[model samples]
Each structure stands twice: as C-alpha cells, then as structure tokens.
Target: MNRERIIAIVAQARAGQATDEELQELADALDRDADGSVTSAMEESLQQGRQQIALPGREKADRMLADILETGQVLEDPGEEAETPAVIAPLKPGWKRYGRAVAAAAAILLLAGATYFLLRQSPRPEEAPVAGTNPLAPAAEGLPAGKKAVLTLANGATVMLDEQHNDTITRQGNTSIVKKEDGRLAYQPGNAAATGLALRNKVSTPRGGQYQVDLADGSRVWLNAASSLLFPVDFSGHERVVELDGEAYFEVAPDNSRPFMVKAGQTTVQVLGTHFSVSAYSDETLQKTTLLEGKIKVLAGNTGYQLQPGQQVVFDKIRAGSKLVPQANTEEAVAWKNGYFQFSGADATVLLREISRWYNIEVVFNGIPAGYELSGKIDRSIRLSSIVTALREGGVHCTLEDNRLIVNK
Candidate 1:
C-alpha cells in the first residue's frame, strides 16, 4: 500500500481495534508490495509498538522535550553549572533515533517476515511468462474447430466425412468406401471395374479419437487419440501405405503383392503388412517407430536400417547417434490405441508436451526442473489439473504461471 494507508493501518493496529477486513487487506497489500514474509497482523503488531513510544530522533522542532530522572547525588545538583548528557536513549526508540533507522528496521522486518511466511505457505514456485510470442491463438482462429480430410478415387470421386455427421458417407468408385453410422469406416471392391483402381482413402477423427478402414488389402489400422491416418482404400500400383500424426498403430494385412509403407515425419517405414506403431508429432524432436510382428525398413534419406520384431528406431533430431534402441514393453508403445497414456520415465517437458496436444492447450516452461522423470499409465480422459496434481505428488512439482506451466528446479 501507499505510505498514508500503511500509517493509518499502523495507527488502528496500535489502538488494538483493527477490523478483520482491514487486517486482511493489509496482509494482501504487504504480500504484494513488500516481497517479504511478514503477514499483515504480525507487521501491524510491530508497527503498533513503534507508534506507542515517542522518543525524539529526527528533530521535528528545534526545542524538544526530553525525559530526565535525576537522583540527588551531589549537594548542589547543578542549579546553574550542571552539564549532564543532553540526549537520553528512550526505552523504545520511536522518535529518539532518526527516521532512517526506523524505516530501515521496518524494511528488514518486512523481508524476514515474508521469507518465513512464504516457506510455511507451500512448495509451489511462482509462475513466470513465456518469451517470444503465442502461436496457438492465431492458429486456432485460422483453422476450423474440426477439419475435413477426404479420399479421392482414381475415377475422380471424393468422399468427405472427417467431422460430425448423422448419416453414412460414401465415395463413388469401382471400390466404394463407406463410413457407417456406427463410426466404422470400410471399403468394398466394386464389380464395375474389371481392373482394381488406385484409391486414396483418408480417415480422420476429431479431438477425442477415431478409426479407419484400409479395405480388403487385409490391412487394418487403428488411429489413436487426436490422430489421423491417410491411406489407400486398396493396395494398388507401387505399395500399400499410410501417413500419420499424433499416434497410430497398424496391423497390416500380410500383402505379399505389395510392400506396406508408413510415413511419419521425415522417416519412412516399409513393411509387408505387419503390426507396428509410429508416433511422429511435429512438435516432438524424436520420430519413433516400433515393429511388433514383422520386419520393416526405417529409412531417413539414404541411411536405412532393417528392424526386426521387438526393435525400435528413435530418430533424434537434436543430437548425434540417432541410434535405434530395443523396444520396451511393447504394450506401452501402443497404449494410446487402447486409450491410455503410457509414460516410461518421461521428463516433465516431455509429459507436458504430450498433455498439451491431447488437451489442446499451449505449454510454456517457467524454469528448469529438478530433472525428475515420470513413468505411469493413465487414462487420457482425466482432467488436466488432476494429472498435474498426480505428477506433483510424485515429486515433480509444477504451477500455472501466466499462461505457461512452470516446473520447479
């Protein structure tokens, strides 16, 4: 608070009649302005002591009254020639010392009190703002709440049903792809075409989750939460393939006739209809590919590696040795397809980044964490704060500072 208000509060406190509301207001003000541990009541009590004593310090007037208690020691106790010490230290040095000392003492008390007050409050660190700019606001404004992705048939026909709908959707072609009311999308080969046609089948879901139909090439794909998969309705010409983002698991129908390919980020995987998982979030630094039941080739530029079952390749963009690592409990990698957040010793930044996408919120780091790792399996439908609280309970502390999630180091 300003100087006048502080003085008035101190006066009221000294009289032992400060109201509760006034005390609370004073506490809030001190907390906000003083940057110290002292609460309003404690500070008020200290101030009250200062007000009660009136020892002259800064000379308000030229002639000030000083208390003198002189005992009759000498016979003629200085009737005219008495030269005792002119200034006496008061029991309480309210005005006896210069105002600077009082102000300094008050400032010290404020700092000490604030430190104690905050330590007793909680372990939560203060949140801070993010640097640079916010990219999500403009992006949300430019894009629709739900976007549309379609599949174009070789015969120049398109099917649209990426968003909410009450009826079935169909694409006209030799092989007609249909999205049923139950949300199960499938493709059927039509007798109209003597030869199979090249079909681009696209399957997309909204914020929660969705699934897709790859048709009778026998390849079945399950798109995970907040994810999409783009593939051909039927394996044609060169290969059977699909593109993905967020997370998706594939059970490729063993097609000896064609090589199934999954494109994730800059990495490409070629497989002949085997089960596999790919997570290539554009915002993530690592593009991960895990082979479940068949052999696959992971290619990045000219560098290609053949991956056996139970092997995984992690393409690390920010470091050397973008080496391939052995797969962990494969269940964890494909847990999203089963509607779970399977974390394996992920750091705070990694966990929050995944949460930000699923919850559709922006993440900004406030400070460095203590370098703690998190591992667990949780349902993605849980509340955001609930997840945060759980992580805090597990020793990784965080707080919402400004619009960002600030982790404590």
Candidate 2:
C-alpha cells in the first residue's frame, strides 16, 4: 500500500497488464488511505505517462472516459465493494488505446470511492423527496441541441431549417433565402435593388436548437440555443443593424461606408468588421460582449468604450453599469460556439441556466450553497445524464425528475 506500489499498479493498469488481484489491492489502498497519498500516486503516474507517451488532449480524453462509462463495464454497482478491475481485457491497439484505458482507469479509481461514500450517506428530511417526486426514478436523458431554427420572412412567413430542408427556401424582394448544402441559411441577392428595403427578417432558435445565418451583406451569424437575430433581408441603409436576443457569435462583413451594429438588451456593439460574441440572456443579470478579432466600440446607455482583440465588456442589467475587461478569456467566452461548456470558477446558478437552455429542461433549485463555484469543460454533445453525473461528482447534489433538474444543497 505504499506510494511506489500504488504508482506501479496504476502504470500496470495503464499498460493493460494489471492483474485482477493487483487492481483490487489498489482499490483497497485507495479506500484505506485518507491522507490523499493513494490519489496523489495515481495522479503522479498519470502525469508521468502523459509526459512519456503521446496521448490525446483533455477533451478527447474526457470523451474516451465517457465512452467507457457508457458501456457500463468500467465501474461496479454502487452497492458492491469498489474493487472492480480497471482494465478487464488487454488493449488491442498501441499507445493510443493504452492512453484511453489509462484515462478511464484513473477516473474510475478516483471517483469510485468518493461517489460510493456520498451515496451511502443518509439524506436529510428536507433533501428527501423533491416535490413528492420519486428521487430514485430513472429520469429520461436529454439529447443535445442540433441544427434547428425557423426563419421568418419580411411578411411573417416562416421556413423551418434542418437537414431535410435545402435549396431556395423563399424569395424576399431581391434576396433569395437558401439553405446551403452545409445546413446553413444564406441570403443570396439577385440583380436589382431589394423592393422591401425597410422590411426585416428574423431567424430564431428554440430551446435545444442552434443555427447559422449568412447575411446578404456576407456577414455570418451563429445563434445559440433559445436565441434570435432580426435583420433586414438586404443591407441598403447607411448602417447595417441587427437586433439580437439571448446569445450569438458574429463575423461582420467589412463595409467602411456602413458600420455593422448589433443591439442586445441595453448594449450596442458597432464594428466595421470584427469577430465577436454577445450574450444577453434575459434571465441572466450580466450581458457580456467579447471581442476575438478586430476593433469595436461598445455603447451602453450614454457611455461608450472601445474594445480590442481579446477584450470583453460586461454590462450589468440591474445596475445599468459596464466594466471593460482588458485581458479576457476569449476562449471561455466562445466555448459554446466551439462545441463545449468551459467554466472557470462559474457560479452554480450560472451553470444551471446554461444547462437549462441547451437541454431544454426546467431547473428547480431547492437550495444552492452560497459561494459555490465550478471549474471544468464538458462536451456539449453528451447526454443530460452524463452532465448530471458530472454535477454529482463535483459535489453538487442534484437529480433529474422527468424534464426538471432539481438541485439541492
């Protein structure tokens, strides 16, 4: 049960050479060691393996672990002793497969003991049954969001955008609204001035849906779940303006004569051409504008502030104030567009709101501990059950009942 022995067992597990007895011994050691030595040994071995061998990045590793758990072979039943063999079969491939085995093995070892203990503990009366619903009932898993949106024409006609629908969806004035081969909505203009230059069109995504729009001006907009964008069918005015609700990422087309502007809530972002994201969910207190490329000016109330690349501005909806972040984590800000949820010390409610929108579920919080924060990155493509498991592993007691995620302190 020494540190070196634990490390050796972990290495064997990673190499797909560990025997059942050795795996059980390691599990016992992890159970007995309350001083964190066993966990440290496992971590050290994982770090050393990563440094010595070629392995996938964190995201890929997470996916591999998820795959293993979904198979229901990596971990034993919670009622049984936590002495499951880390790797039951020899790895077929080389280091690539070995890397995946190790990732799953380490996660199983680390989470097994902790989760078992937490589950074995008795629950208080207040945390017992949530609204008379069975806490132990199997909740239906939520599917990930996909390319689903509705395009509303100038005259209030609607077109559903999805895989089954393609080609020219409709015609608006001189603009032909087409659903491109790549599942994106595009506004292609024909020869002649657009007749209804004053009329506007809108694209909206319901909960658990997302869509992309290629504007007539060549600007591209990626709308997040439960978001909408309203813009003219053709850019004919002095300023190309768009109204946004919820969240969206924009790559504005350059036009010196006409600056592109996005109005979200009480904030307005004006740019000639830039890559940026605007998050202005009505349920959230803060609205943020993050700039990834080029320069832009953010106008909030009567005050205006200029932002450069890698900068962000947060507007407080309650206080009607704004603060500029000189060095922003632009990657975290646009993680949704890139296909994941990246959290760095994010609050519990903040994370729940995102889960609610993406999973299209209701979040009923019995009580969230004050000052609770979470930091991690999860693939957005995973099922809602996986997300709930992750939340439980992070010490956030919660359960999914029907379509509602009930969180308790």
Candidate 3:
C-alpha cells in the first residue's frame, strides 16, 4: 500500500467507516511492522491520555517506530498499556454467521503503516534467490543448492561437476565420461578389452544439490540432493549392479540377459528394465522402493516383495522386514525429479528432513510440532520462509535463526 492509501484507511478506521477488507489489510500490515509490539512512545502517550488522538499521518507512525528499536522486538502488544484501542465498528450482517471475526480498528493504523514500510524496504521474493546462490532469510546465510555433484573416479580422483561442460570429464576404462548439453553425465562405452575397465565411479550430490547421469547401458539415473550412486563405467557381468546411499530415480535399460540390481542399505532392489525410485536415507527408518513402470523385486534377508507398476516396497532397515503397498502414489515419489516437494499427509520429521537437505539448514525441534500430518506440494526454488510460514499455518510455531530452524509447539 502507498502512503496516501494507508492514511486514507486510517482515516476511515478512526471514523468507523472502513470496509472489512481495508481494516484487515491494515491489521496485516501492522503484524508485519517493527516487531509488532507496543512502542515506548505509544505507552507513554497512552498514560498521558492527553495524547489519545490517533496518529494523523505517516510522520506520526514514523516517530512511533523509532521508539520501538530501543526496547527490542517482540510479537506481543502492550494492549491497554499502550495508546487507546482503536474502536472497531460492528461487522456487516452475515459476517459473524460465517464464523469469521473482524479485528478491532485500533490496530489497523499500526498494521497499515508497517506493511507499507516493509513492502517498500524489502526486496520482493522474485529478486531474492539468484541461480546457484543461497536465498536465505535475513536471519540466515546460505545459498540454496543447485543441480551439481561430485564424480569420484575409479582411480580415487574426484571431479566437481557444477554444470554441463559439453566435453569429456574423464575416461574410465573404454568408457568416455562426458557431460552432455542437457546437464547430464553420459558414459560412452568402447571395447573394454582394448581400453581396460574401471571398477566403479561414484556420483554424489551435496545437500541442496542434485544431478543426473546416463549409464553405458542407456540407463538413466536422477540423484536427489544428499544422495550417491556407485556404478561401473560399463556393465559386462551376468548382472548390472549399483549401490545407492540416499535417494534416486532410475530408468533401467532393458537387458533380459542381465538383471539390474540396486543395493540400498541391507535391502537389494532387482529389476530387469523398469522405472522406479528408491529412498534409503540413513536418517530414515524405512527404505522405500516405488515402481512407476514395469516390475521390480525388493529382497532383504529371506523376505522378498514383488512390486507391480504403481506399487511400492517398504523395507524396514532395523527389522529387515518388507511390505507391499499395492497402489502407490508414483507422482509424489518422483516429484523431486520434476522439481517439487509433494507430500500427502506426510510426517513433519519426513517433510522437514527433505526441506533441510534442499535448504542446507539445520532443524532442531524444541517440542513436537502441532500438525502430525500435512498434504501439500511446493516448488523447490521457494525460499525457506515460505515453508516455515506454511508450517505456522498448520499450528506449528517455528523460528528461523542463524543457520538453524527451531520448531516449537
């Protein structure tokens, strides 16, 4: 809101003629003001009673804000101890019947002024986070992660792949490891007998980063942030095998002669040629293998579960037990690859863990949050404040401090 608009709203509020929407806007503006608390000037003016007149313009509002910085910031207002409560007019008929209440106009002036001030001072969200830069809030400092990863060569040499180089990154055995134009790493396999075969090269993404790779067999893998995949440059054995430490989505190349196997923790996922996703984070108790196309089998100890398309296998890491969810939400499972965090009644612990990885921040729970489960989908590029604000709406109180997210009751 502009200066003139705010002043107009305050005039209407003092006259008890402001519309509900206008008053609500003022209230919202005030809540975003300098800590939203009672200012020393307002307190003193209230005690004087002689100063009970409403602030006439932006200049008075400006003076009131100057007095607040000395006492520090707090969310609570001093209420009766501050300036006289701005009288609120009775709501329009049928408003109360809708079960929504209107706030008193006394707070409208403060809100409108503060809201206008903040909107003018702060950079809009669209200007905040640049590509490959940390887009943290004022309380924190850290760039949000991007599509990046580290490639561990078979000879123990590590190469940092920040973006598609459109050139050869390295050569392992007869396979030419190159970064394609689409930001994907590809292994072009030659005759292994002539160039020699490298055992295994590992690709891993740091927290807040992700990467994709195309194996020699035409298989594709999308590694999520804080995840790793280990595979040979070229597969020639009876079966193609890869080891995973975190989460990844795989589109396996069909080779009926050789089975494609993924070893995630103690459980092994075996597939011929299929589209599936695996979540095996060390912090999580269960390793999930959800299939989106074809069929796959999850094997742990003597227990094994076959998953059809749209099914998921939940393997408990501790119990080594496995179960099949016959009809799974494959879209949610692969949402990360498409750049979204999709949740349908997810636990706070699970949702926040994924958030922590992407934001490269810390999460410390002072007490369990209010909502045990929430269903939503958010773009990965949004700032941390957007997520925290959503949580607050779900009755979860949290504070984003320096490099840490403190979740309260």
Per-residue error (Å), model 1, residue 45 = 56
Q: Lowest summed-lDDT stretch of 10 residues in model 3?
A: 115-124
Backbone clash pairs in model 3 (N, Cα, C under 3 Å; residues 3+ apart or in different chains), count: 5
* Candidate achieving the largest TM-score: 2
Clashes of each: 14, 0, 5
For candidate 2, which ten residues in a row score worst on lDDT?
Answer: 114-123
Each model's TM-score, in the order given?
0.56, 0.74, 0.66
Task: In angstroms, give how far residue 404 of model 2 lies from its true place.
Answer: 0.8
Q: Which candidate number maximizes lDDT? A: 2
Candidate 1 structure quality by residue, lDDT tens digits, 212-231:
55465667777654666766
lDDT of 3 by residue, 54-80 (tens): 444534443433333333211232222
Q: What TM-score does candidate 1 reach?
A: 0.56
lDDT: the better of candidates 1 and 3: 3
In candidate 2, which residue pairs clash? none
* Angstrom error at residue 148, model 3: 1.2
Q: What is the lDDT of residue 168 in candidate 2?
A: 88
Clashing pairs in 3: 29-111, 30-111, 86-106, 134-143, 134-144
